[model samples]
Target: MKRKLLVTAFLLGALLLAAYPMFSVAASSGDVGGLIAESDINPRAARTVESYSLESSHPYSNNFDYTWTITEPGATQIRVHFTKIDVENNYDYVYVYDYAGSQLHKLTGLYSSGGWTAWSYGESIKVRLDTDYSVTDWGFAIDQIEYEGGGGGGGSETNVLTDGVTSSSSLAATGDTEMWTIEVEADALSMHSVLTCGSADFDLYGRLGAEPTTSTYDWRGYTSGGEDVTFDNPGAGTWYI
Candidate 1:
């Protein structure tokens, strides 16, 4: 009886651990929506403000009026999906700003004709409305701007990686290597690079100067073709140019 009880407890714990990952993945994948504030809108005549209807196939089908605002900019990403299609063919716009009202990015494009379309901004400081259009009897939807980070660690500007040298042909080749260049910059943090091949297996290396020097880092594993690869920052360090 004692042995049976122990086995059951062990099985339950394993099941719980497996269940956690499944739940997390499901939660991360889904649709999100919300309102926009009046202040974030750019004062340009080219800007068209419309109401967002998450349920409508055409969220901005007609002239709808409303005002909304976002308190935090760096933490929001505005998105809009269209539901209706007409000869007018207006496009949905998404904008972002920092806490100080600095423009971050803007995306303007037409939504899917009859399918669900989405746009997103990772971290923003605040957002505001661009129009006073009231939306009634429309099928448009607006999602609450959610924040998506580039992934773990600090922003790309601060982290740098220097993988040691292997060979010129070792980097991933879509077809040509001349199109590639090593780039780096600073924002809130630094970032580094790790290369992966898309067609052939290759080794990746990094260094600290315009040319390969005495110091370098090699990838622990080789990436295969058609594999999505990521070059993560191995903390803050000097990288080859």
Candidate 2:
């Protein structure tokens, strides 16, 4: 039972960003020349669950200035998603920092729901809360913190999936799906994806604006053998796979 799934995408000139799920499984024997080293990149374990969470002190605290850093040994990238935010409009703030302590994002006021920090490079990121002695509110809660372990972090401004790149991953168990993204520009020739799964069966799904699932998807490669999918004159924007 081979545990590896190799996916190769060819975009005439579009940029590709491959985001895989993490698994504790051993490295696959299959070739993955295009993927970052195993030590630096850990894809999500499963699409169904978000990884970790970070929350400000309940109701936060006045005159508070503290930082929390999340680190994964070899993570190449770290992303934070805020599910809720309720801090003083301008008197208080929640700041996000990269491994080197440089400011990355700031969350303030009540309308900060569903905000995501720009992707941070390196294995660690710092979240700091600075409050004045005036007022404080419910603060914020980060529902998920995603990190891709291992590699020489930083470089590309965006996680573009390079053209004609081959990336591979080993799914440790059943029902594991790796997620990836590609930014397709207008009037491009075409975008193609080739999925090669060893003996194990896997399904490929794609959507334009959001993550795809077995039930809802814009394109699917359902055959038992390796699958191929392509889009011609595809719309401009992000395409999830």
Candidate 3:
């Protein structure tokens, strides 16, 4: 399939300042990439490394998966700062996870602000990149910072997600789906979600008060550009996407 591919790299941990600690890795098989561990880049109560870059194999390499991991057993909080990012809007993206492997956040062109920043909630961090055979971009680059004693962690919260308020995730390629949970107020007028960001093509699916799957979705939206999936007075409990 001849596709307009976009090429870019991911947070594979590249040394910015000399003597700075970092690591990098790449994977071409399966949906998830193997974790790249580097002699424990997490420091304890000491200023060891500055930043790490997660780069891709090459621009528009078609399909590939890359993974990067940072573990600070001492709860050494980590912060990620995005420098240059352009991931085909949403068709390609990097998913970030907390120390406990929770979906902390995901990034695409829609969420890219002037060097956006995110922090980890646990003692470790995992960044994985999944790309498609379609459009590509210059991927993304992030700087890693560690704080000792879990204090001064640099507002290191990476999840900018809000239920109906305004949050988004990405599906890197075909058969790629991003799932998350959101809270809906009691008997609210309506609870909704939208494809407010990203270029390419993506379908939005939701399951009110249930888990979302490609087949079990209660509400589905396959429209292009600013696709909005709204539910009138949805259940007051938790909703799946």
Model 2, 76-152: lDDT tens digits are 77766566566798789878888777888676766433445666787667777788998778776655566665432
Q: How far is candidate 3 from the true structure (C-alpha RMSD, Å)?
A: 17.3
The TM-scores, one per candidate, come to 0.20, 0.42, 0.39
Candidate with best lDDT: 2
lDDT of 3 by residue, 86-132 (tens): 56766787777766667766665533332423556665576667778
Task: List per-prediction Cα lDDT, in the order shown.
Answer: 0.27, 0.61, 0.49
Show model 3 residue runs off by greater than 4 Å: 1-49, 58-60, 110-116, 150-241
Model 2 per-residue lDDT at 99: 76
Lowest summed-lDDT stretch of 10 residues in model 2?
A: 19-28
Lowest-lDDT window of 10 residues in candidate 3? 9-18
Model 1 weakest 10-residue run by lDDT: 1-10
Candidate with better TM-score, 1 vs 3: 3
Give the distance in Å from residue 37's predicted Cα in candidate 2 to where it truly belongs: 25
The alpha-carbon lDDT assigned to residue 138 of candidate 3 equals 60
Which numbered prediction scores highest in TM-score against the true structure?
2
TM-score, candidate 3, is 0.39
